[model samples]
Target: MPVDSTGHAIVAEGLRKRYGGTEALAGFDLAVPKGTVCGLLGPNGAGKTTAVRVLTTLLRPDAGRAEVAGFDVVRQAARARYHVGLVGQHAALDEVLSGRQNLVMFGRLYHLGLARARRRADELLERFGLADTGAKPVKQYSGGMRRRLDLAAGLILAPSVLFLDEPTTGLDPRGRNEVWEAVGSLVAAGTTVLLTTQYLEEADRLAAKICVVDSGRVIAEGTPGELKGAIGGDRVDVVLRAADEIPAAMAIIGRVTGGEPESDPDTRRVGAPVRERVAALTEVVRALDEAGIVAEDITLRRPSLDEVFLRLTGHRTDERAGERAAEEVAA
Candidate 1:
């Protein structure tokens, strides 16, 4: 049955693809709403890149169906390609070309006329905050600047759907921040983006929704907060001034949180999942004060994405998800 793609910028249903014995994508399904960023997260060999390839019309799927920008990826590949842009793990700019020249070249390649290309080049340079340094060769640009230029090139056609495969793989914190701002601006302007990244922090920051892929299928999907809350809602922890207070502290915390409390004598810490985080913390503190249990520290915190990924996928996100070429080739 065909799934309606009326309001989705990207849709995939039971999408399957195999490379020899490797099942790159097995019954994968996804739906990304229009004008939003959908983060695709997976460990290596999890079919993240293969799915992107099929959705962007780069590779044909062996089975199932997908649609991008309201066009069937298989039956209407050309139309889908026209309305989409792709930025891979690495920068695709020519080092010798100035940022302005590179964007102009991209515009021309997209078949814009010389005048139109030049105009578009200037427009992108200004839009990405590269206008002041547009004349500098890409080789002279900083890592962040080069990435911003790559992003600008991807937008040369003003694509309605953009696929980013780890757009900040090697960038330092500052460079990554710059690219993050650029991506935010694109979504603000109504472009739908599908971002595949290993950086949980990146997805947590940029994606309105996240899908966790494992074994070539989506094992989990939700907003960052929702996903984090899935494992355990919120936790209250207390570090007692004396390790001997563990038993008493656990009883107090368990009563307030209404959950079993665990204690670590070595760390002098007692922790438990809490329903009402602030209120529970307050109640626990008052209880401890009345019991004359000296407390060194008390805090409430939610589960991190890393913990969620581990709990769901049974492994942490490999930092080496960058080796896509080999993975896709095997796929």
Candidate 2:
């Protein structure tokens, strides 16, 4: 049951949101093609969630404009709400209710008749791989199962667009994989999903395009590969046995790769971006050997999304998450 949305399903222009002294969004802009997954990639407190809240009509922007599924988010709030579904970071299932009952209850709250609600619940259970456990109480479900059910509850009416905010935040790897498969199936069925996450790997796997935001503004926007390329093509890394040899290794690697090398004195490691993989590796190994640096590790690999995020956000994802957590506790 596909909804009536074609072309760009979501659009935003110069969005701005300020929370007292903090500016969560500053001139943010976006465009997401219909039927494709678009990722909002940023560290915690980078305004990813704030932007989602504004677009989903939960928060009004201080300035700028946004449209979802062809409806203005502010002026047409009711119609926009009807076409979009939201799944927040935490699970919101009723602990005492069976998975099927929870979903049916959501449908009923959406004004679906009892019979239709039951049918929708069954469809969601089967689609999200919870058919076997539909009768089981939500408390009996695992982390992944509960998250999928949350997504299903958001989709009570087959919304044309869905917003997921950190859907895999605390799940184990297997659980994350399960949620990923469920999202993939939804996209295949023609739902345009806008996902916000701190995990770069999630955007790489699920998003056709990624928007990187920091300090309330979009710093970059492109396909995953394109964003990685902005940092560099390939990465050459070396780990030395002696921490005292950091300077020598950094110089050699910097000169060989022609890019600034990052030194990790804590780990006696150095890494730099490389455009010519084979040639750079050869030069780096030869230089280290001539300089009598006993490297315990040397490898060439493509830049991970972590590296991309670091370059775009100017901070490590973990560091930002920790800072945000501390701020929340203090507040």
Against the true structure, whose lDDT is highest? 2
| Model 2 ranges off by over 4 Å | 1-6, 276-287, 299-310, 313-318, 322-331
TM-score of each: 0.80, 0.87
* 48-70: candidate 2 lDDT, tens digit per residue: 99899998999999999888989
Per model, state how many residue pairs clash: 0, 0
Candidate 2 whole-model C-alpha lDDT, 0 to 1: 0.86
Colliding pairs, model 1: none
- What range of 10 consecutive residues in model 2 has the weakest lDDT sum? 322-331
- Which digits, one per residue and each the tens of the lDDT, describe model 1 over residues 1-331? 5677888999999999999999999999999999999999876678898999999899999999999999999999987878999988888999999999999998998899999999999999998899999999999999999889999999999999999988987787789889999999889999999999765668888999999887788999999788766766667889999998889888888887888788889999998878787888889999999999999999776544444555786776554553432232222
Q: What is the lDDT of residue 121 in candidate 2?
A: 95
Candidate 2, residue 126: the lDDT equals 92
